[model samples]
Target: MGLGLRWYHFALWAGFILVMALMPEFVSKGTLRTMIFANFLAIFAISWDVLSGRTGYISFGHPFLIGIGAYTTAILTKRFDVPVEYAIPAAIAMTMVGGTIMFLPALRIKGSYFALVSLAFMELIYQLVQVIRPDLTGGTRGMSGIVTLTRGAANGYYLSFSLMIIVALSMWLLMRTRLGTALSAIAMNEESVKGSGLSPTKLKLFAFMTSAFVAGLGGAFYVHYLGSIAPRALFDINFVFTIIVATLIGGASTIVGPMFGAFFLTFLLEYLRPFLPGAERYLIYGAIALLLYMYQPKGLYHIFMSQLDRFKKSGDDD
Candidate 1:
């Protein structure tokens, strides 16, 4: 069954909004800067969870779709002299089309085959971008001095958080509808869903498109926020791992899990930065992530849920 929002959900969100609104009052700029990364990570993770996490169709090439959005916007605004407003929407449309192309294979295959193909797609995009047009793509160095959405960390934090909140709530609410149930049903048993007279292909396409939309939105804004875009950074495997790990460690198939997971993973990285600076940091971060994954594969959200269940049971017994 699809998850339903409860009264507590409203209260929880309201409290979250209040806290976010007040965050700058107490935290240092450095922390807020870290938070801005977390917010963007959350967005990327949510984009990931929408298709791969929920539908059980793991997309190793999610960064591919995101790259489409980021590159489209970057190229449009930088080389073509297009305005930011138009570039962003154009990026979204491009991603949707890219997603459809990616989704086509799903109609025929899945699992390892699909995963490998998606990885190839990402590599294909990465190679093509650098070689296709050195003049526009800036060759190996990547394009810099792009337009920025916000000036300082504080404004950036607010902007990112607002988008995060909107995406989280919107996706969460959408998943509560019947469409969510159908998508999950497809994930669980596509054959069964088909037998039930539902069109699995159509449902899967919708999920793909939805994931693309979020990826595009996040990527377009993320590039603008950073004021730069690069093929190597956008298509890197580490970026893919981070998104997958955040979603898995946050509790896949749950909207809140990815968001929470993104922040948790980001802070973990920040905390370990001192002890393990530079590329060495991922070693400790990877180890901690593996331990957490082993300890609670269902993620922090599942742990909280199990504890909550036990508490309720104990109260009833009492």
Candidate 2:
């Protein structure tokens, strides 16, 4: 059943990708810009899913890891005048270091306590970025005119879309492996995984490191795409909320779910602009999200699978 379902999912994704590849032909340039943001959001959301969603680590400070990557590359390229090619990899390395720092807390903390610690880490970075090195970090204003990896809307769209697809496909394949099952097992019960002769610590370290790598890669590339970065933008609670919400609403622990969530939330926000056009729109959006999450905590993925099962069963019965 799992194998059959996997094939079905794979085919569906293939078709979806074909459609997405052709989307630029139909949509306006502004919509393509929005898609670029959605792609990055999906990357960050998927990165969060690998650790928090799969392992049940519930990291609220994921942006901290992402910020470390973004800032590392930003400072390296902006101040030191390093080439983006070298700086991007350095940024990813910095995020790994930051992830290791986070892993230390994960050793002692779990659940809500762990979440609080992550949040604190994010807040710490937020403050430090503003105060500690105003000269290099650019203080509150942040560095601008950093760099662009591509020119024009179509090129930018393709760059982001290709990155998103590669990350999504890579993560999707990884999660299908035994390691993925083991990590998910850790989420269910760490003690059980240990009793089964696998070190939970090692599995978790792997998860954290991998998660940080993707987040960092996405953050670094995203910065270059925008050619700018700010402390507030990188470390914002709202930003964290968006990543988490996208993952949850689309279905946590499922790579495709977060991508769907990113696009869904992005388009929803765009659709609402004509109606609400202000902060209050989010109030409505939040209410809908809260209700859906409470009703189906597993998210739209489960809902989708359930419906598909029903359809198949009905066909079999007929």
Candidate 3:
């Protein structure tokens, strides 16, 4: 359960934070806003990576967990007049409970079956919110004018980036521990993990809970940042696709990969806006993501590391 961290790990993290902290001085406000989305997207992407990416769970209904957090906080803050501090924690707790419920299906099903069940859960919740209690849930139209956490783009960017970094660093350290190795083992071979005397059930539960925790935190903060929530938007398949694609395209099992992937995808879409300016922009974005994933299935992180290693070897030869 030791961290197993190296000196370079801390150095690299410090360098990245320093660079990002100085970005506002160099970038425009519009770019700062774009970065804010990237930050939150990174958080969601990491959450997915922790569960599906690590455990081979392949959650098609991750939006189910995220929506729980978002809707929970939204209702608590708007309908009940709950403080943001209290509401966010409640949202996270509710999400973990939702995650635990989702785990029940995993006990009997897996692979595509498990994925389908997760998707069903997402759809079920989507329909429930609209029909069950429109007054508090905001129904189909959704809720707006919710309390915002930050005042402007710069502040929003800082707050989001800080949260993303904290999550990334924490997850990184956690995954470096024996529990992380156990979860990854479950992804590779549940039977083997069982043979080794580790309980696959408990490992899967840990992964689910961890994923839900991060998803809740991200979803809660994301709604506050936008000061709104919509059922369609929160539970959209496109949103789920973006999150999964970001994780895979960035490199799944590794945390830093998803974070970088989120930024890459966000900026790519932002730069494509002037040229495409419509939903069609996603077509080009998807094409590029496909090409990059095909080129380096291990993701940009692995590609970068491989190149760095090659350079060092070449210098040694010289």
Candidate 4:
């Protein structure tokens, strides 16, 4: 069943895209801008899900990979005068290489130790970018006036939305393959996977690379979208917290879950702006997220599936 595909899956995805594509027509430009952020967040959340969510690795420093991509492109475009077309691809490659180098060592450990090592990697990069080459990295202040992919809220929303959909669809398809199952099995029981004659190391390497690819893609595009990059903003704990929370709240081990979770978290924050227009909004936002997570640890995805199943069963009874 892991490899199986159903008509309803395609139908559901199509319906969702249709609805989202129509959003620009009805919502205000400010709301569209907010959605652009949501689209990017979804991309980041999905990247996190691919590695930590599926493999049980639980990386606390995903932004480390993201920062690599952002900095690579920013430096290339701003300092070296490289064309964006070349710079973005270079950014992705650099991020993958960086992620592999940083994460390969930590793979030897497990659980909280692995998490700490990843966090350390993030902190390491954070300090390195600021001190190693201030001119290239723009030091702590970061680089601005980077190339932007689109203009106007409407155009930005479409670009971001398109990228988010492509990433979501690609990942959803990938996770249905045999390799995905192997990676997932590693999460459930590493020893058992080894016993089954699969090399857990190779599987993990593949998963890590895949996650880094997505992170790099998202990070590169994200910086381009914003036309700037700051070390503090990219490497901050709050940023890490948001990405992990969105993935968990949406449902781990599922692609669509994180996408919806990103939108949900973004909109929730926007909705609270009027009432608590400061840091206080985060308090209430975090509380609501905590409550939802507590009530449905499996995430909104499971709740939705349960309701669908229940409705099907009721129709059969009738």
**C-alpha displacement of 174 in model 2, angstroms?**
0.6
- TM-scores of the candidates in the order shown: 0.96, 0.95, 0.97, 0.97
lDDT of 1 by residue, 230-258 (tens): 78888999899899889988988888899
Which has the better TM-score: candidate 2, or candidate 3? 3
Across 68-149, the per-residue lDDT of candidate 3 in tens digits comes to 9999999999999999999999999999999999999999999999999999999999999999889998889999999999
Global lDDT of each candidate: 0.90, 0.90, 0.93, 0.91
Q: Please say which candidate is ahead in TM-score: 1 or 3.
A: 3
What is candidate 2's lDDT per residue for 1-318, written digit by digit as tens? 132245777788889889989988999999999999999999999999999999999989999999988888989998999999999999999999999899898887899999999999999999998899799888999889887899887788899999999999889888987888998998899999999999999999999999999999999999999999988878988889889999999999989899989988888888898998987777876887899899999888889989999999999999
Pick the lDDT winner: 3
C-alpha displacement of 55 in model 3, angstroms?
Answer: 0.4
**Which tens-of-lDDT digit does each residue in 137-204 have in candidate 4?**
99999989998989999999999999999999999999999878888898899999999999888888
Candidate 3 Cα misplacement greater than 4 A, ranges = 315-318
RMSD for each model, in Å, please?
A: 1.7, 1.9, 1.1, 1.3
lDDT of 1 at 238: 89
